[model samples]
Target: MDLRRIKDWTLLPGASIEVRQQGRGVWSGLVDAVTADGEILWVIDPSGQRRLFEKAEFYEAWAIEERDGFHYEVTKNDDNLQKVS
Candidate 1:
């Protein structure tokens, strides 16, 4: 999987996203913005708290939809995974 392409996806404001932090909990929220260089992301949780995350902080991130919930399917291999959305 080309993680760079995933990171570069144009996540518009109000887009739903789920991020799994390394060795920590997961967070799901509406995307506030993705930095123009695709290095940082700002998300607003349901409680209205805004959080910032750098690309390396999370192990996985998925762009979600309100209707189907999650946009992609993940296939895992030895120490690797691919996302098919």
Candidate 2:
């Protein structure tokens, strides 16, 4: 029931996540794919780059869950992202 632990959440492609380090925006976008073991996540940043992120120390991933009154959608497989109200 908190952001500290999201292991229970099923991370899927197209999910919105904004990761940051040292109070700076690293990157945020719709998830493109996830490792089979769920240890890594691949996201397409705004610059059209495929970046890999691992849930570990010094990393914070923000997910706009249903309770947040917002959601994200990937219009197409190309990772066209849109935040829905």
Candidate 3:
């Protein structure tokens, strides 16, 4: 996810997200808040559990309106997040 490409969405307090970690099941949640420098995101899952994740940990995320059977892949390389769809 290029910071420029997804920054707006991630900053929205209520934006919904779906995250997948390597070898782990997917996690879904709502964005609670974002750090001032935009390096970390605070999310609250459906169970009301809060978690903090570095921007790079997000392998996939998209807004609810854009989730109509669409998929995204986020990867980090050379300190940049790249999003492939």
Candidate 4:
């Protein structure tokens, strides 16, 4: 799997993603919701734990996609990752 830096994209519900901050792994889970204004993100983990993160400049979001015979161009998100510091 390759990770691409996104500059323009939106987080949609039910998508799987790995969030990184300052070159470190943060959280990886299913997206629950993103505020209409695009300033906040909510994700649900395997244990049904829901967490909220605020948009920040240091956050990076990479959408994990599987493809080969089923390749997909990951939609990029310009908005930074959320608050968790």
List clashing residue pairs in candidate 2.
none
Alpha carbon lDDT of each predicted model: 0.60, 0.57, 0.59, 0.58
User: Model 3: which ten-residue window has the lowest total lDDT?
Assistant: 1-10
Q: Rank the candidates by lDDT, best first.
A: 1, 3, 4, 2
Residue lDDT tens for model 3, 15-83: 677554552436668879877776677778999999876757754444543443334568775686755
How much is the lDDT of residue 24 in candidate 1? 42
Give the worst 10-residue stretch by lDDT in candidate 2.
1-10
34: Cα error in model 4, Å: 0.2
* TM-score for predicted model 2 compared with the true structure: 0.54
Query: What are the TM-scores, per candidate, against the unseen true structure?
Result: 0.60, 0.54, 0.52, 0.62
**Shift of residue 62 alpha carbon in model 4, Å:** 1.1
User: Which candidate number would show the highest lDDT if scored against the true structure?
Assistant: 1
Compare the candidates by TM-score and give the number of the best one.
4
Candidate 3, number of clashes: 1
lDDT of 1 at 78: 53
Root-mean-square deviation of Cα positions for candidate 4 versus the true structure, in angstroms = 8.3
Write the number of the candidate with greater TM-score, choosing between 2 and 3: 2
Per-residue lDDT over 8-75 for candidate 2, one digit per residue giving the tens place of the 0 to 100 score? 22354676666666545688777788777766778787788888877665555566344443344433
Order the numbered candidates by TM-score, best leading. Answer: 4, 1, 2, 3
Give the residue spans of candidate 4 off by over 4 A.
5-9, 66-85
Give each prediction's root-mean-square deviation over alpha carbons.
5.9, 11.0, 7.8, 8.3
Between which residue pairs do clashes occur in model 3? 1-82
